[model samples]
Structure formats: C-alpha cells, structure tokens
Target: MSTTAEAPSSSSENPKKDTEENSESRLYQLVKNLTILERRESSLLELSKKRESFPQLAPVLWYSFGTIAGLLQELVAIYPSLSPPTLTAHASNRVCNALALLQCVASHPETRTPFLNAHIPLFLYPFLNTVSKTRPFEYLRLTSLGVIGALVKMDDPEVINFLLTTEIIPLCLRIMETGSELSKTVATFILQKVLLDDFGLQYICHTAERFYAVSTVLSNMVNALIEQPSARLLKHIVRCYLRLSDNPRAREALRQHLPVALQNGTFSKVLEEDPSTRRWLSSLLYALGGEQYNVGSNI
Candidate 1:
C-alpha cells in the first residue's frame, strides 16, 4: 500500500545545537531568577552579602551580554514615569534589581569586557540620568554609583572614550555635590579613575565646560573634609591634579584654580598633618604654586 508513513528525519536533527540551545536557556533562566531575588526588599541586602551566589550568575552574564541589555531595557520599560523621589516601591524594586545585576556583572574581570563591548554606558545612561536628577533614593543612587565604580576598574579604551564623550563627568560632580557620603566616595573614585588616563585628562582640559565642573567639585570637596577616608579621597584628587597639570592646557586650568585652593590653605593644611596624603599633594602644590613653593623636602 504505497509507502509507509514518512518518518520524521532524525538525520536532520542536530544534537550539539540542541544541547547549546538548552544550556543558553538554562543560563538565561538563572539570570531571571537572580533578578527576581534582587527585587524583594527582604532579600536585597541578603543577596548582596552572599558573594558566593554571584559567580553562578557571572559566567552566564559574561557570555550573554545581550541578555543584560535586554533585562535592563525591560526593567526600565515597566518603571513608573514618576521622578526618583516619587518612585513607587514596585518601580524602585525593579530599578534596584536591575542595578544590582549590573553591579555584579561589572564587578568581574571576565565579565567586564563583554559588558564594555556591549556598550553598557549607552544602555545605562538613561537610568544614570534619572539618578543624577534625583538626589534622594539612597539605595538607587549608591547602586548606580557602584556600577560606575566597577566600570572604572575595567579601564577599557572604549569605556573611557565613551565616558569622555558623555556628560558622565558632570554626572559624577552632581553626585559629589548632593549625594550621600558613600555616593560621594564613589563619585570621587570615578573621577580619579577617569583622570588616570591621558585622554580623560586632556578631554577635561580642552573642554571648557567639563574643566569648570571638575575644578569646582574638587575645590568644594577639599574645603569640606580631610580626614581618614576623606583624606584618602583627597589623595586621589591630588594625584589626578598631578596628572592633569602635566598637560599644558590642564596646567593652565589648574593654575587658575590654584589661587582659590591656596587662598583657603587647603593645600597647606594637608601638607602640615596628613603625612600619608602629603606626598601626593606636595608635587601638585608645587606645580601650581610655581617656583616659590619648595617641594624638594617631600623627597
């Protein structure tokens, strides 16, 4: 009776491809669940404390960078249109979870490259812009800053170039101006790392608007505090100045700001007491002070 019913062809099936597809699906599921874990306020702090839980998600996140973008986009999509100050708990939870995932993703060296390659700054800027505009939402603000800190550690060329092209420096200054102490610490860390590169310093020096922001924020920070951790942050600030002043345009920028710092004895105060921080600032002070300020004793 003619042919037997045609059998579905096993020959056309690819076992290896199926296995990979299944594995990817499993990894994605893991990310989704971890994100869910992040949203519950009761579990949020617990999740952060458990570092062991992070590696499970890291490999998948590193390998599935597109998924990270998609997750962030989806979270933003469902978020309330209200400002950060008035964000509903639901919206805040979603934003918190998304940021936590980003922080974890950015933290690992293996994962960091994929994150940078994925142009995370582009995906993240919308959220960052919101956080910058709203000074409250402490958790959201700190988490956003933490993500920036993690990216700074990567020091990737593309990431640095992207930062230079954006208002990120201004954003960091905004945090410094109004955010919590932890946030200010993170913001300072961001500027310190950003200025570590010649390109970043040059960009700040050449761009009048950016130069103004950097100078003003740093000046205020030094005026505000200089002890222990604050002193530590000042060390980074002085080191950045040293690098910035090395460039002709940046030196001019520094020279103009130096008078204000000197007028307040901000530079001299550090030199008098904080021996640990004194070393980094002395050269910068001398450079800014020209030949009159002897820094030879620092050696």
Candidate 2:
C-alpha cells in the first residue's frame, strides 16, 4: 500500500478508560458535596424545619445519594486490590455517610425506590469482605451486616449467596463469640437470614462445635434477649441452637445449655407453641439421640 493506515489513537482504543475516569471524577464531586452537607449540619437542620421548602431539590439529593452508593460499589468491584487495610479504613468511614443517606431514603417509602431497586445490594456486596477484616472500625462490620439483613428481607438470592461465600457466617460467629451484646445481636440477625436456606443450615450444623464453644457469649446473648421487647431475638436463638444440635459435637457442647435454655423458658415456649420451632426441635432431638431412635440399626 502507498500509505499506511493510521494507528488508532490511545483514547480511541481505550474509550472505557475515559468513561471510568469520568465516572470516578463525578463520584469524587458527589462525595465532596456530601461532606459539605454533613459539615453544615445546622443548615440542614434549619432546612428540615422548613416544610416543603426544598421539595424541588429532594429528587436531586436522592439521585445523587444513590449514585454515590453505586459509584462506591463499582470502584470496589473494579479495583478489589485497592481495598487493603488502609484504604478500607477510609472507605468504611465513607460508607457510614452512605448508610445515613440510605437510612433517610429507607424511612420514606416513596423515596426508597432507588435504594431498594439498585443501590442497596451494590453497596452491601463489596463491603462484605472488607468489613469482615476491619478491626478498629468494627462498627462497619455491624453496619454491613445490617445492610445484608435488609437485602435478605428483600429475598434476594444474589445478596444471600454473596454473603455466604464471603464467609460472613464465620466472621459473624467470631464477632458474636467475642464482641458486645450489640455485636452479638447484629450477628444473630445476619445468621437468622442465613438459616433460611438449606445449605446454610447444613453449614451451621457441620460447624456447630466451633459455634458452641462460644457458649459464654451465647449465654450472654440469651440473657440480653430477655430484656428486649421483641420475641424475634429469642426465637432466632432457639432456631440457631436447634440447628447446632444436629451435629454430634455441637449436641455434646450444648448439652449444658439445654437445661438452662429450657428452664429459662426460651426453648420451652417455642417447643410448646411455635410449630416451626417444634419441627426443628424434633429433628434436632432425633439427630442428637441417634442411638435411642436407631436401636435396630447396625453401628
């Protein structure tokens, strides 16, 4: 050929890079706005007092908030290597702001569509592993679990499996084993969601001993539940114990707690009145007393 075809320009060859850079720049601007808004707390409070004063801006705020959440998720996913301890510590703080915005949207059903439709699961998924290992910012772990709980309530398998494979159950159990009552409560909530699936239930059964070894923590959690108004916490504890009893090691470890659980009327009430609880208890009892029920079977 008389003339060589011109080489494509770098920008032309890498359009995606330009698009990503633009997205990152816009995200930085949005985050800056959020920071400014947070710093002007009194102004926001004053604005809140003015009813319908900023109605026109509400949609814009919501959209920006959702976009920030989406951007954080995309950034984390595209650059997982950047989520090291130092970076994650900073990101966790930013996530707190994101969660506040999400909570505001969550409180108003009409404004919740953007979050419920997309932003929630996106923010939640990427933070799973990061939150698990972040120590000094432990609150982020509980916050992350709360987001997962919300997604689970929404019945999203994608969210559930993401949590499962992230080893969230083990991390939660470890936190519940060593952390405060609030931590245990948060962990229990996530575990309750996990127990909804058969594979999750089986996994808990298989690792029952590890969970049961933290009996002192479990006892404290049960005691704390007694003061709570909601019966849901007590019910979840019972279900967790019942599942654990399926494993021989767990059964032996929890044998000491059984009498206390029954005497305290936590398990007893459920065994008497809750049909699902009764069914699970029956299966657990059968599993624990295998020889008693399988007298005719060869060992």
Candidate 3:
C-alpha cells in the first residue's frame, strides 16, 4: 500500500515539473522572437520587416516596460558600439535597426511619453560627447539630438528639469558653434525651447555655474550671428537672448556681458543690414538697458 501511494506522488510531481519546463521553453521562445523581430530587415519573404516590427514592438514596450527594463538598458548600452561609431561588430546592424525603430516609436505622440518616461534622455545625453569629438558619429549625434529635441518639445517638467540640470546647455552651445548648418539649426531649436520659459531663465540665473554657462552660450550665439550674417538661426537666437534678459536675475547676469557684446559692434553692423535681425537685436539691447530704438529715426 505504501509503495502504491509513493508511486502516485512521484507521477504527480513529474507532471508539475513538465508543465514548468514547458512554460520556461515558451518564454524563451517569446523573448527570442521579439529580439529577432526588433532587428529584422526586409527580405524576400518579409517586404516590410522593419515597418511591421514597430507596431508589434510598441505595445510590448508599453505593456512590459517595467518587467523588461533590462531591454532598455541593453538598447542604451549598445548605442556607442554601433557601426559608424565603432567598427563592424557581430550585431552592429541589428543594434542600429533597433535604435532606428526606437526613434520611430518616439516620434509618435501616443508612444512618446511612455518612451521618454523610460528615461531615454539620461542615456542619450552622453552621446553628444561622441558627437562633439568624432566625425563618424556626426550623423548618429545629429539624429540623436533630433530625437531628444523632439522630446523637449513635449515640454514636460520632468524632461525640462533633466535637461536644465545637465551639461546639455554647454553641449548645445558647442553643437551650435561646430555642427553643420542642419545640426546648428536643430541645436538652436533645442536652445530656444530650453530658454523659452521663466523656469529656464531662473534656473540659469539662480546658480553662478549655470549663469556663466549661459553667458558663454549667449556670447557664442552672438558670434554665430557675426559668422553667418544671413543665417535664420541668428534671428531665433536673438529672440532667445531677449527672453533670457527678461528675468531680473538674468538681466543682472546679462548686464555684465553686455559691454563686451556691444563693444564688438557685430550687432551694430547687422542692425543696419537685416530688418528682422534689427528688431530682435533692438529688443535684446533694450532688455539689457543699453539702447532704445528711436521710433522717429532710420533705426
């Protein structure tokens, strides 16, 4: 009797163990399938391979973000190791495919917040250093900046706070100075959005370190104006400066830099040439309490 009871207990445990093993196998297959899908390229059988993956990936990302946080960690980790940034690796193309998919996902308004909430900016900001230093990474850098710039457009306080407190201001200044015209335009958009609100101005003005960084940024923008007299970028930058000077603390911080800018005569020279530039420059000058436009004069 005892032997007969023991045999049934052993048989029952084996079925439970088999069920668990089957569940694990299914899970492994699911992960493998998703990973392959994320990196899939179009082939004879799969004409829209990458495009098809986005919709599939988006929901999985949305529903399973917390559970598979390591997927994001891996995504962020593999960025610098991609083709242009590094030589051909075993999975360079795959990683690039994944990042490109991510960029598409971020571009969607519905998916954007969830994607940003995953804290992708934290990973993305460091790539700007590579962008600043390497030619190969320039395209990657510009695309990355475009994505981050798009997130900034959301104007979420969490995103804005992260941007303001980081080295992003200095990085944006550097890109504006050294990046290609298209990159420069995007960098200015980032800068413009960053400094659009009182919060950004106050953030800069409240701290000596930030105020100095922004002062340097303002100087660089003025220099950009001098270099590219006809560039539309300078027009937006001039307006950005005027917005900065609106804050009392910012006005005071700017007061110290006004003399050097005015002394250079870049503004004076440009003022006579571009009417729109002149309007923004005049507003900037007035904000700094330096020069008032004479309503009756040619100015």
Candidate 1 per-residue C-alpha lDDT over 1-299 given as tens digits, one digit per residue, 9 for 90 to 100? 68888889876388888876766665556554544534334433344455354455666655553556545664566435535447555665656666676688787777777776666756555545555344335666677777878888877766677776766887788777777677777878888788887788778787778777787887777666643335556666676667777877778677767535433454564556677567666667677774555555442
* Candidate scoring better on TM-score of 1 and 3: 1
Clash counts for the predictions, in order: 0, 0, 0
Candidates 2 and 3, the one with greater lDDT: 3
Writing each residue's lDDT as its tens digit, candidate 2 over 98-178 gives 454444444344554555555444555444444334453465656665655555665555556666665666666666655
Better of 1 and 3 by lDDT: 1
Candidate 3 clashes: the total is 0
Cα lDDT of candidate 2 equals: 0.53
Candidate 2: give the clashing pairs.
none
Candidate 3 structure lDDT: 0.60
Residue-wise lDDT of candidate 3 within 133-241, one digit each (tens)? 4544566567668776776777766666777776577778778777777777788788778777557767767777877776676577666556566446666676677
Work out the TM-score per prediction. Answer: 0.71, 0.47, 0.65
Candidates' RMSD to native: 9.5, 15.6, 12.7
Which residue pairs collide in model 1, if any? Answer: none
Q: Rank the candidates by TM-score, best first.
A: 1, 3, 2
